[model samples]
Target: MLKFQEESLRQSVNGALALRHQINPFLDAIFEKGITNICFLGIGGTYASAMQTVSHMKEFTSMEVFAENAAEYITTGNRRIMDGTLLIYSSVTGSTPEIVKAVEKAHAAHATILAFLDNPNPHLRELCELCISYPQNEQLKLFMAADRILFLRHEFDCYDDCYENFDCYLADALISVEQSSDSFAQEFAKKHCNDTLHYFVGAGNQWGSTYSYGMCYWEEMHWMATKTVSSGEFFHGTLEIISRDTPVTLFISEDASRPLSLRVAAFLPKICANYTIIDAADYPLIGIKPQYRGFISHLVTHAVTNRIDVHLEAINCHPMEIRRYYRCLEY
Candidate 1:
């Protein structure tokens, strides 16, 4: 682990596992009260995680789910959002103005609020009907919350077995990702150290990872230009931008959407001279079951791609922690 703290990562996994107790009771109370729809509302990475969870849930469950941008949802409300809605808001800082406003609006509408926070503001914490504070594994918290909701509603029959294996599977993800960092990810970073722009492509649940990496990691952290497109949408207009010199990165997951990534892979090599494919299938999983691979593919790809950040920092002579305009300036 080059930039990762082992204790912090272990603590995060344990913290997320402990949330099952808290989440079970919260869902018990919500189902007793009756919830009609689930809405995951946030900005940036939080919202992207919500979208990924929504896609994951839709594979088996028939629940009404929506992932919305906090600021946009406040301005143009969804008709399905009412008193019976379960609104989930994720923010580590809890000081994000847009999320705070979304909480207030949901509260006024009598919607039930479930928030994942780190050191949340007193006002924001008070507003939530149920709050889970775990700063390290925010994505895991969201995924677990969504999965629990599905199980509670009687959508996922095997949820108990899945629940029992949460800690083990997540630990596997943390470990496998570190192993991947030392191998393919480091090589990819060193190869692309001089590249200024990148085009990212993914499909299914991985589409969220592509978007999150492009915006949160590349644009926000590295101050680089990145264009992320879904594999299905890459042909419509995005394919025209592909040239012999384009720096393209493709994310291949082992889900039902593997065919979509395969299609892109088949086409890119024929046209583009500079392109790299990072497939999650290449990673080894010691403890994870074969059936769970699709469910955990996003985490594996995220772990692999994130390793490049540390390498890019060393090669490009810019620390990933340096941000010029995120919180330092007014938006």
Candidate 2:
């Protein structure tokens, strides 16, 4: 466990569960006033996370949910972002320029804004109608909020049963996944440490994790070149580019799109010997219901990949926190 802190991880997961108490009440209040649609607006990693939520909502709930890149939303506004829309956002700094501007636009449109911030930014706070400062597990909190909304609408009857397990056992289950996946992660780091390019593929709810891991972690943090594609779209143009030596990883989850990833998994072995498959099914959540595993597969994927990130940092001798130009100069 390089750079691992068990207590901190446990606390973060537990704290996210506790935050649900605060979140549910606020959602209840907002629903009373009426909400026509839900819009998830964010930048970079946050935007990808919003995509995961929207994907899940599409499968289980009929709610009009949209995930938009904050910068793009500012350029071409969405007609759905009007009076009764509830705009949801999550940010580490809470002051990204694009996000701030997007929030301003949503505010002017008479949409109610709710933001989850990792750090307090008064300026962003002033723009949001409801802002909660939670330093970790923002994705989990976002999913919880989404589920709570669905529960209130009578769309998710198992919400209470699912969250009861989340509150009591999710942290331990996630930690167990980290422990179980550590050896594979270590080997993965050693094997791919110097690879020039990485191609990641995933489907369903796990697609966001695949996208974020490629762009945010491998590219931004590790300074490695990478490309991500959804499993459903892989054969469109991406499949021909793969050769036997090309490094590819497929993330498989228990959602409806699992078959798409499985299709890729089956094809990769015939053409590419360097392919890796990280299946959420391999790690069983001891206390979580079988029906709810799809909802938290992204979290499980993170727990496994977090180990790989630490190992990669050690092998590459490049600290994960260092960036050459991300925030060092203005564009």
Q: Put down candidate 2 lDDT per residue, 1-331, tens digits, no spaces.
A: 7777889989989988888778888899999999999998888999999999898888877879989899998999888999999989999987688998999999888898888998878888987788889897867978988998999999999999999978888999999999999999999999999999999999888998899999999999999999999999999999999999999999999988899999999999888989999999999889888988888988998899999999999999999899999988897
Give one digit per residue, the lDDT tens place, for model 1 in 64-111.
898989889789977777899999878978888888888898888888
Which residue pairs in model 2 clash with each other? none
- How do all models score by TM-score? 0.95, 0.98
What's model 2's lDDT at 101? Answer: 92
Could you tell me the lDDT of residue 18 within candidate 2?
89
Task: Give me the runs in candidate 2 sitting further than 4 Å from their true place.
Answer: none
lDDT of each: 0.83, 0.90
Superposed by TM-score, candidate 2 places the C-alpha of residue 147 at a distance from the truth, in angstroms, of 0.2
lDDT of 1 at 122: 89
Relative to the true structure, candidate 1 reaches a TM of 0.95
